[model samples]
Structure formats: C-alpha cells, structure tokens
Target: MIWIDTLAQGILLGGLYALFAAGLSLVFGIMRLVNLAHGDFIVMAAYLILLLVTLMGLSPFVAAIIAAPVMFGIGWGLQKHLLNRTLGNDILPPLLVTFGLSIALQNALLEGFSADSQRLPTGAISTASIDLGVLTVGVLPLLTFGSAIAVIVGLNQLFYRTELGRAFRATSDDATTASLMGIRPGNIFAIATAIAMLVVTLAALYLGMRSNFDPNIGPARLIYAFQAVIIGGLGSLWGTLAGGIIIGLAQTVGAAVNPEWQILAGHVAFLIVLLVRPRGLFPRAVD
Candidate 1:
C-alpha cells in the first residue's frame, strides 16, 4: 500500500517536472537551439508572479495570466535581438550565450529577491487531498498533472493543425528554404520562443505553489528538465512526459528503499536509459 502510494505520488510529481521540460522541448523541436537559461526563465516567471501577488494582491492563477504576455514579450525580444544572432550551423554560440544569460539572470534575481526561499500561497488547495480507493492524492498535484497534459495536447494541436505550425515545421526543416517560401525564420523563431515562455509561466505557477524556491535553484531545475528531455528523447513532447514519470518513479522507489538515494536514483535511471537507448525512449521520426 505504501509503495502504491509512493508510485502514485511520484507520477503526480512528474507532472510538474514535465511542465518544466515542455517549453524546453518546444524550443528545441522548432529551433534546435538549446536555451541553457530555460530554468532561470522559469524562476524569473515565479518571481514575476510573486511580485504581482505581493503588490496587486492577486491570486497566483491571476498573476500567471498577467505574467504570460509579459513573458511572451520578453521571450520574443530576446530571440529577435539576442538569441537570433547566435543561431547557425554551430551550436556552441547559443549554448555559450544562454549559459552566460543563465548566470546573469541568477545574479540579477539574487540581487533583486535575495537568497531567501519563497513559495506562493495556495490557501485551501495547498493541503487539499482526495481519497482514491487505494490511496489519497493531493489536489494540487492532480491539477498540475492535468495542466501538463492539456499543455501537451494544446501544443500538439498547434504544431499539427495550425498554419503557424506549418510555418514552424517548414522553418525547422530548412531555414533557407523557409525564407525562400517567404517565411521569415527570425519571426518564426521569435514566435516559438514567445510560446515557450508562455509555457514557462505555467511551469512557474505550479513550481512556486508546490515548494519553496530561490534563484540558486534554477540550475538544479534545469538539470531535471534536461534529464527529462534527454531521457524522453529530444524534441518529443509526449516522450518528455514519460521521461518525467520514469524519473519520478525511480526517485520515489529509491527513497522508499533508502531516502538518501532519491536524487541519485533519478540520475542512475537516466544513465541506464542513455546506455541502453542512446536515442532515448522515443526519438522523433523527423529529428
């Protein structure tokens, strides 16, 4: 029964991790540019939510809605002005630039918000739970899981069904050819980043509500997101969710056996997967 509960809880927790990875996956799928600052952007969004909640006295959900557009603009501008210049045949430039951006963001956040950990207040929902026949599950975790699924489904539809998505596929396949087709790769990239930042805002909402967070924690979250992305296979959204669940289950089961091995267990599982399947559990056919 205890093991069952742990497994359930772990799967729920993976939803949050999946949220963290979704934006990363989207950007990679579209642009093939890895934003090393991806997690810091999530932390930045959390702080933005905190700011709105503290000053405007709005709920976290309301704050997220307000922050989404602001984040979108920031992402668009960043891609248009900064990251766009870094894109090319060589991947190192973007990696180096985003890595520097990550450090700068961490320092900027630390200067502004300090190192103290903070969490968003959830009122009743923070502690709310429901009993399933086998076990009890937290309402917040269930909501997070549901939101992750919705985001994935929405993104899939957008990628597959929309004209913009067609543009994305075209740009991703060959930027020069996309340009010949009158699709501005720059604009497409900007839109992709903006959409990614919107997803980041959703990730921030759950992260801030779920646990205490400080600026320094972004890199750690980045590690988890990176592992999830790699374990699931790069550029595959559904696979990312599966990867998160695998890591979550590994951590929970490891902790059940020995609490100290929780984090290590996740890393071990990732390594095992990488060793067995270098391309990941589900590599995209196109990628």
Candidate 2:
C-alpha cells in the first residue's frame, strides 16, 4: 500500500516534469537547436508570475494567463533578433549562443528579482488534499497532472489539426524545401519559440507552487526536463509524459528506501533508459 501511494505520487509528480519537458521537446522537435537556456526561460516565467501576483494580489493562475502572452512575445522577439542568426548546418552555433543566453538570463534575473528564494502564494488549494480510498493526494498535484494532460492534448490537436502545425512539421523536415513551398522557416521558428514560452509559463505556475525557487535553479529543472524528453523519446509528447513518470517513480521509491537517494534515482533512470534505448522509447520517424 505504501508502494501504491509512492507510485501514485510519482506518476503525479511525473506530470509536473512532463510539463517542464513539453516546451523543450516542442522547440527541439521543430528545430534541432537545443536551447541551453530553456530552463532559465522557465524561471523567468515564474518570476513574471511572481511579479504579477505580488503586485496585484492576483491568483497564480491569473498571473500565468497574463505572463504566458508576455513570454510568448519575448520568445518571438528573442528568436527573431538573436537565435535565427545562429541557425545553420552546424549545430555548434546554436548551442554556444544558447549557452551564452542562459548565463545572461541567470544574471539578468538575479539582478531583477534578487537571489532570495520565492514561492507562489496559494490561499487554500496548495495545502488541500482529497481522499481517494487508498490514499490522499494533494489538490495542487491533481490540478498539475490535469494541466499536463491538457497541454499534451491541446498540442496534439494543434499538431494534427491546425495549418500552423503542418507548416511546423514541414519546416522541421526540410527548411529549404519548406521555404520553396512558401513556409518561412525562420518565421516558423519564431512562432515555435513563442509557443514554447507558453508552455514555459504553464510549467512556471506549477514550479513556483511546488517548491521554493531562486534564479539559480533553472539549470536543475532543465536537467529533469531534458531527461524526461530523452527517456520518453524525442518528438513524442506522450512518450515524454511516460518518461517523466518513470523518473518520478524512481526518485520517489528511492527516497522511500533511503532519503539521500532521491536525486540519484532519477539520474539512474535516465541512464538506464539511455543504455537500453539509445533512440529513446518513441523517437519521431517523421522528422
């Protein structure tokens, strides 16, 4: 029964990780460029929410709604002015650029928000729990898990049902070819970044609520997001969720046995997946 509770909690925690990963995976799938700053962007979004909530006494959810569009604009402008220039046949340029961007973001946030740790204010919901026969679960966790599923479902719909998604996939396959066909590769990337920032905003809402966050913590979140994306397989949203769940389970169960083993356990799961499936559990064939 304890195992059951742990597993359940892990799966729910997986949902949060999946939220962290989804934006990263989306951008990577569309453009082979890995944003080393992905995690920092997440932290930035959290700070955005913090600013909004503290200034206006708004709910985190309301703050997220406002921050997402702002983040989208920032992502769009960042890609348009900076990252677009870094794209080429060689992957090194984008990596270097994003690495620099990550450092810049860290310093910027530290200057703006200070190094003090912060947490989202949740009036009643954060501490509330629901009994489900076998075990009690946090309401915030359930909401987070629901949001993760909603994000994936919404993304799937956009990818499969929208014209923009078609353009996105086409550009991913062959940018020059896409350009010849009237889809602007650079523009698509900008839009992709904007969308990725939307996901970051959602992830930020949960991250700040779940634990204390400081400007320096983005890289750690990036690691977990990256592990989830890789373990589940690249370009597959559902697989990303599965990967997060695997990691969550490993970490929680490890902690159950020995408190110090939690972090190590997630990394072990990632390594195991790498060893067993080099291409990931569900790598995309289309791209």
Choose the strongest candidate by TM-score. Answer: 1
Q: How big is the RMSD of model 1?
A: 1.0
Per-residue lDDT of candidate 1, residues 21-77 (tens digit): 999999999899889999999999999999999999999999999999999999999
- Model 2 TM-score, all chains together: 0.97
For model 1, what is the alpha-carbon lDDT of residue 140?
Answer: 98
Residue 275's lDDT within candidate 1 is 99
| Cα-based lDDT at residue 208, candidate 2 | 96
Candidate models: Cα lDDT each:
0.94, 0.93
For model 2, residues 164-275, the per-residue Cα lDDT tens digits are 9999989988899999999989899999999999999999999999989999999988999999999989999999999888888899999999999998999999999999
Off by over 4 Å in 1: 285-287
